[model samples]
Target chain A: MTSISIIGTGKMGSAIAEVAARAGADIQIIRRRAGAGSSLERGDAEYGLVGDQLTGELVVLAVPYEAYPSVLGHYRDRLDGKIVIDISNPIDFTTYDELLVPADSSTAVELSQALPAGARVVKAFNVNLGDTLSTGTNGTTTTTVLFAGDDPAAKIAVADLIEAAGLRAVDAGPLSRARELEAMGFLQIVLAAIGKTRYESGFALLQ
Target chain B: MTSISIIGTGKMGSAIAEVAARAGADIQIIRRRAGAGSSLERGDAEYGLVGDQLTGELVVLAVPYEAYPSVLGHYRDRLDGKIVIDISNPIDFTTYDELLVPADSSTAVELSQALPAGARVVKAFNVNLGDTLSTGTNGTTTTTVLFAGDDPAAKIAVADLIEAAGLRAVDAGPLSRARELEAMGFLQIVLAAIGKTRYESGFALLQ
Candidate 1:
């Protein structure tokens, strides 16, 4: 049984927990406040929140892009030998036109640089909408989950989580691909405006 | 009956034609070839191999981003006093990570400057995907179409067409909003790799 812990229990955080729980993973959640959808009976899901930090195989950071630095800083010490999945898309909500991160670098790439020397931070789940995360298939349209990271092992672990959620996992090359993946959200915004597609609306990768 | 001419016959151009034809509009398609989907013989719809050199009340430029200058050059003379709709997003496909258009200006702005003083250029429909453009509603979800223009009258005309296509026309403010709307496609590209969202995605502007 793979033990998994999810930080941030908002819509996406809760949805991930619900799906992971249903999939029979030892799901644990940590939130700012103690509530119904809470994962653990302790403090936050940071590294120091638990006695052991690097015990779990995977840690899904479902927090906002703005809070990434603080989250990483608080948990960096304990993230060694574990996969850190960054699912936040650094969008400048103020303008909604410009990306907050530098043009040359993506939020995921920046996070990788900030993490511990051996800590693996993979980009995943930033593209999918929280509303449409369904474990069951909707006809022939199987959901596509994209992930990217320098560490192959970490990428595989994250991919397994996506597969466990009943969606197909696609390895979208290296960490640089995160830039493209992050920009991909713009497409969803367009489709979402027309009510023709859903946040969970995904594409079939044709080579 | 409003006389509308589509300046390109690509996937997006054809999809718009299909919607326009279904909505009982007089559509003139300007394409290089006449084919099955061509509306040449419909009598209601006209087919012209020539570009938008001579235009009517509405002229939709559905050409690729790079072909904008040539298209504008070809049609600039006839575009005077006409309502020109720009549906092109300046996407740098070569460098998937970067935007080709300068940070200060957008493609729509460039086109606006290129057009005659009398011609009204409105930026609309660039964010919509050809795949999700169906005549009917997707169950209870209503389609939201976005439009932006310096001229209110031009915006209204484009909005009217959007409504005829079974979607709600939203005024995304002034022509500068085109920059935000154009950047939206790049964001969509990022989401596509993740395969969790669709091309027609957009956000609702609420009070």
Candidate 2:
């Protein structure tokens, strides 16, 4: 079974943990402090300290875009040679209309730049909503988990986890393509806010 | 039948004319010169000069993002009280990695600002690829035509045209949401370049 470590205990983080746990993966939820009640209530997962040794091969950074630097700083030493997944959409919350990142860059690319040399950053789950992640489907269609990474092996590993969780995994090419993925995610959020899809919709690439 | 006028005779413009023709709309194709052989070969569309008097209630600016200023400049006097649809995606073609428009604005919003006071600019068909617009489907699934405009009546008119073309019409709220739609279109183009969807795929908002 693929072991997974999820950082952050927000709705998205908890939802990812739930899905990963349901997929029979050995799940560990990492919080800033063990006493924090924000950790998910899933029985298959155990809460761990952020600075401790991460037992899972895959570590998912499910925190908001702003918290990335602090979280990465706190766990910098432990993240070397680990496969890190970035699911944060760098949206400008003030207006909720535009992306907060640079016009040519993405949250995943920025995170990848700040990571330790060996940390392989893969962009995933940013496109999938928390509701879809928890339920694994949007209405009659299965939710698609689009991921992008520089490492082929790392992308395959992430794809394996997504497939295990009863979702379709789409490889969206190199890590540079994270910009596009994040843009799509931003669009979906705006669409939801505007009552186009009611926040219940997930993006599907029609064949 | 909903009468429609299409500006420009490129792939996108021609495809829109074809779809409109297929849907039984009274289609008129506008070219810089009436003798230009580049106009759509469809038997249903009547060819006309760009500076000529347009008869359709709805006019589609299917030109490139760069040509918007010139096209709108020449037709600025004639566009008063007309429903103008902006289908241009302001993508930075040099890099094909980022949008050329301002971060907070969109092509439609920019064009609206440049149009005559009474010309209602609606953002539609910018998210749909030319292939999907031509065929009206990515596979068995109908392609979604997401549109946004500040005017309620204008959006409904554009939606009617989209539905008449046998595609799904999704109202994505006011004109401000065009930024998101254009961003989504840029992402789709990038996805195609990266071989994620092969340019044959269209985005669908699955419930």
- Scoring only the second chain, what is candidate 1's TM-score? 0.86
- lDDT per residue for candidate 2 within B1-207, as digits (tens), equals 688898888889987887788678898888866666454677778888877778788999988889877887678878888999999888888887668888768888888888878999999988788988888886556788888899898888888878887888888778987877887788777667766665566677754
Off by over 4 Å in 2: A18-24, A32-39, A92-94, A138-140, A164-166, A193-195, A198-200, B18-25, B33-39, B92-95, B102-104, B138-140, B164-166, B193-195, B198-200
Give the poorly placed runs of model 1, Cα more than 4 Å off. A28-54, A77-81, A91-99, A103-105, A116-118, A134-153, A168-207, B31-42, B47-53, B77-81, B89-99, B102-106, B113-123, B127-153, B167-207
Over A116-162, each residue of candidate 1 has an lDDT whose tens digit, in order, gives 78888898877666654544332234555667788888888777777
In order, the first chain's TM-score in every candidate is 0.82, 0.94
Clashes of each: 29, 1
A131-158 per-residue lDDT for model 2 (tens digits) = 8888887656677788889998899989
Per-prediction share of native contacts kept: 0.00, 0.66
In Å, residue B101's CA in model 2 sits off its true spot by 3.6
iRMS for all predictions? 9.3, 2.9
Q: Please name the candidate that would achieve the greatest TM-score relative to the true structure.
A: 2
Residue A44 lDDT in candidate 2: 78
Error of 2 at A139 (Å): 4.5
What's the distance in Å from true for residue A50, model 1? 8.0
